[model samples]
Target: MCLIHFQYGEHPIFQLIVVANRDEIYDRPAEPAHFWEDEPEILAGRDLLEMGTWLGISKNGRFAALTNFRDPSLPKRPRSRGEIVRNFLKESVHPSEFIDELAKMKDCYGGFNVIVGDQNRLMHYNNIFDEKNEIFPGVHSVSNHTLNTPWPKVVKGKKRMVEYLKNNPGQVDIDELFEIVMDREIAPDEELPDTGVGLEMERNLSPAFIQLPHYGTRCSTVLLIDRVGNVTFVERTFNSGHFKFEKSFRFKIQK
Candidate 1:
């Protein structure tokens, strides 16, 4: 997922609320969100090219999502960052412990930012900043940059999420959450963050929703974990920048 805006452990009824968009090359083959035949306990979309995932959750409450660090000039790496999330979801290791493992081979992959844990606890790790952090409750975000870097979409999405939660108390509207991330408004030139992708390319990716000739948002996902440990995951996928099919799954934490 490229842009992730969330309220983690700050809602009255929900422990974690996430709205994100997965941006990628439209031609990359991928399966919509589903339980894997091999790993039925795990639920997530599959990246067919790498056989990994950008975001996923396990029956035992393990959760993970990843965003590539937006640096096009870096040397090509031998590893696919999708495995970062897929590996975490498949294993039972604590996020803190996984950091120790990732630190050893971080250079093998391109720069990436990942958050992993359950509803009650979480950690953020990025090879670019090369830092690990325990996530505190409240509104936060991450795009192609570090966590909470205040990119236009990140800041805007966070604000909208906070507003949505505040306005609708005691309820989590899945559709509204999805709508928040559907914002197609592009960031003004001055408000854009320079990620070395140049002004034109930056502008193309500035919106919370993005559509380019080849590279654009492939799916928008909203994951909600409530105080009672109920989990909801929804994925809306697009075909060549148009709506394709959507998948929604709801289940209680197996913990």
Candidate 2:
């Protein structure tokens, strides 16, 4: 996932709301979000090459998402960062415990930011910076760096999310959340972050929805969990900068 905006425990009716986009090369084979056949409790998009997931939720209210840090100077780790989400979903450990354990062996994976939680609470952990935060829930965004790092797209998306929820009090227009993730407007050069990637690459990645010659956003995922333990997950897939199809799932949080 490249850009993610989520609010937990901030609204009257909703417990958790998330809007995220997964950006990758056009040809990376991936399975759209679904209940994994082998692990029926998990619902998420599959990274076929790595046999892992970028984001997902379990039938019992467990949720997790992963994003890679934007530093090429870092060495490649033996493990795929995507496994962080997959392992969190597959395990029954408390969110904080899971993150604490990972922190002890953080160097096994490349720089990454991951969020894991249930309806009870949310936690943010990054191996690159050796940081773990208990998210308190107004509105938060994370990208290819730390959580709420003030990157152009992260700032813009979080602001839009706060406004969207405020404007549409008591109800969430799922499609509107999709609109936020679909934004392709590149940020003004002055607002772009210099992450060591040259100016051209930075500009290319400045937009919430990235579109490049051979690589771009593959899917946008919107997940809403209500206070009553109901979940609505929607994923829209794209190809060559065009909308392809959408897959949605609605289930009650078992826990």
Candidate 3:
């Protein structure tokens, strides 16, 4: 499970604020945000050859995320979760329209919760076994459920996010937001959402060192989009594997 906290058009000079966590199995190889020779303009990760990223943003003001819908009973399908992120970054479609397109392809894949947004709009999509839904704008949280499933983690994460937003308001920059999104230390007794892997193995195989690897916050990122169409992006990762995020960069979209 992953969390994203963002505010659009809330700051004086900043037009957008984003903070997110990239959650995945500890063993999955991944690179930090970087531009690949194959995909030059893409800056989040060269070729994230692991699970889909929880969130990403493009210089064109497009942003997206993919979350697995908890379903231990459903049979797994033959699809690449990474493709979801690739498709979103490679395309320039609007969030709502992109979600509509995703719904049509739902049958081709397994259960998932997806969010795509920009400075002007945001949308969510859910495809469980028998139920499906689209989330509307306003403060909302998407975890293993469709959206706001009342799961303890979902509820607590949303509440914490709201409290942070309320207290920080316009002053909530990327760094502060990161602390909130990566706040796994809070409420230690709160049961964490199981990642399908056993707790024992999770502890052993998970990334341990926050700076090197084997277990820790895998990646932290922030994407800002100003009203004038300028974008600022930053990403950091722990460990050395298939992923490595380059230094932060700021750029503008061609009008």
Candidate 4:
């Protein structure tokens, strides 16, 4: 996932609420979100080329999402970062242990920021900075850089999400959440982060929702988990820059 806005243990009814967009090249082959046939417990969209995923959740209440850290100077790692989320969901390990292991192998993969959790707790880990953080009850976000780095879209989107949740306190409105993820407004030039990507490319990727000729947001997903351990996952997919299909599923976490 390229952009993510999530609240944990903040709202009265919801334990965790997430709104995220996954960006990639339009031609990259990927299957829409679904429960894997081999592992019915896992629900996520698969990256066909790598046989991994950017985000996924398991029936046991395990959740994971990954984002790449933008840095042009670093050499690409041999391993695919998507496996970070895939391995987390496939295993039954605690988030803390999983993060510890990831930290040890940080140099094996490209720069990345990852979030892993279950019904009980959430953990954030980044390989680029070699740090591990515990997620407390509150609002947080992570994009191409560090988590909550105050990028324009991250700030605006977090505020919008807070307002949305406040207005609709106990309920999760899929449409409104989608609206927040679909925002395409570009940030002012001064507010854009210089990630080594040129000014033109930086502007292109500034919005909460991104659209480029060949590379853009491929899917948007909203994950909601209530106090009772029920989960609602929804994913809207796009084709060659056009809306293609949407898939949603609901399941109660086995306690």
Candidate 5:
């Protein structure tokens, strides 16, 4: 997932709500979100090339999402960062322990930021940074940099999220949540962040929803976890900004 905008512990109905977009080359082979045949308890889209996932949730109320830390200086590592989310959901481990172990092997992976843990606690980790942070209550976002870094899209998404939640209280509107992440408005060049990517490329990637010709946002996913341990996960896959398919799943947490 390249962009993740979410609310934690602030909403009355759902304790955790996640809206994220996955950006990749259009030709990269990937499947829509589904329960894995091998890891039956895991539900997430699979990266066909690496056999890993960018975001996922498990049967036991555990959920995790990831974003790459954009840095042109660092060379690609031996591992796919997607494996971090995949492995977290596949194993039965505490969040703290998982984060500690990730720190030990941080060098093995490329620059990336991960928001992981179960419903009760979520932690953020970036290999370039030295610490793992406990995601506090309220709206938070993460993209190609650190979490809540306030890039144009992150700020726009978070503002829209807060307003939507504030105005439409009591019940969750799934469509509206999806629409927030579906925004395709490109940020003005003056506001674009200099991530070492050239001005033109940065402008293309500035929007909450990117629609480039060969590379862009491939999918958008919204995950809702209610106080009663009920989960509603919806994912929409696309190709070059054109909608292809959508998958929705709901289940009560095992624990």
Candidate 6:
């Protein structure tokens, strides 16, 4: 997913709330969110190349999101996309510690942006350019940039998300949050990073259409991690040809 809008410890009741969009090519192979029969602890879209995901949670209430870094300048590094998510689910490391370990590797494992957090803190790391930043306790949006610094889509999306959150500050469910991320109405004159998947044509064909059979936002996910170590996850997949939601899954995290 290219963008993640999250609120951690915002409400007195809920612990964590996140809305994300998984952007990728139209032809990549992937299955909707499902538990792997062999690896039951993991829950997300299976087998996506250039796919971003909200990885499985740990027993200790840790949450992580992995997205590709959009830097074409960096040399390719050796790292498996699935392995990154697997490691997050398998380990109990803090966000800072996890980022520290990622920074030591200079092998350029493709461009990646990882956000990991819990009830108390949030950390974001960009491996493409070797940059890292932390978000204080507040409503924030992370795109392909480092925080909010006027990167066209990032700036415009952040403003739109904040405005939505301000107006609808009530306890939001997963679907409501997904609507905010799937919003593609605001078109800026600035250029966007080319995904080589022909998003322009897709957008032109269907502005509100999510082309599932070929390309577009393949998945919309919302993850809620409560204070008591309970994690709730929901994912929806769009139809490839019709751009309508085809399937969905809702489940909780168990050891």
Q: Each model's C-alpha lDDT?
A: 0.90, 0.92, 0.60, 0.91, 0.92, 0.62
lDDT of residue 162 for candidate 4: 88
Residues 1-255 of candidate 6 have per-residue lDDT tens digits of: 666777766655556777777766757677777666655665666665644344555545556777665544656666665566666655778778888887887254667777776667888877756778887765666665555434445555556656765666665555666666666553442444453436564233222223444556767777776656566777766545234553444434444
The lDDT ranking, best first, is 2, 5, 4, 1, 6, 3
Q: Report the C-alpha lDDT of model 1 over 201-252, residue by residue, as the tens digit.
A: 8888999899888988999999989999999899999976789888899999
Candidate 5 local lDDT, residue 75: 89
Each candidate's TM vs. the true structure?
Answer: 0.98, 0.98, 0.75, 0.98, 0.98, 0.77
lDDT for predicted candidate 6 compared with the true structure:
0.62
Flag regions of model 5 displaced more than 4 Å: none
Error of 5 at 207 (Å): 0.4
Q: Candidate 4: TM-score? A: 0.98
lDDT: worst 10-residue window of model 3: 203-212
Model 4: residues with Cα > 4 Å off, grouped in runs:
none
Candidate 2 structure lDDT = 0.92
lDDT of 3 by residue, 95-201 (tens): 66776777777766677877776677666677664344444433466655566665554566567666766676554466665565554433232344455656653
Candidate 4 total steric clashes = 0
lDDT of 2 at 128: 83
Q: Write the per-residue lDDT of candidate 4 for residues 1-255, one digit (tens) a residue.
A: 899899998889889999999999988999999999987888999999988899999998999999989889999888999889999998988899999988999999999999999856999998989989999988899999988999998999999988888888878778899888899998999999999989999999999889998999999999999999999999999765578888989999976
| Alpha carbon deviation, residue 119, candidate 4 (Å) | 2.5
Error of 2 at 66 (Å): 0.8
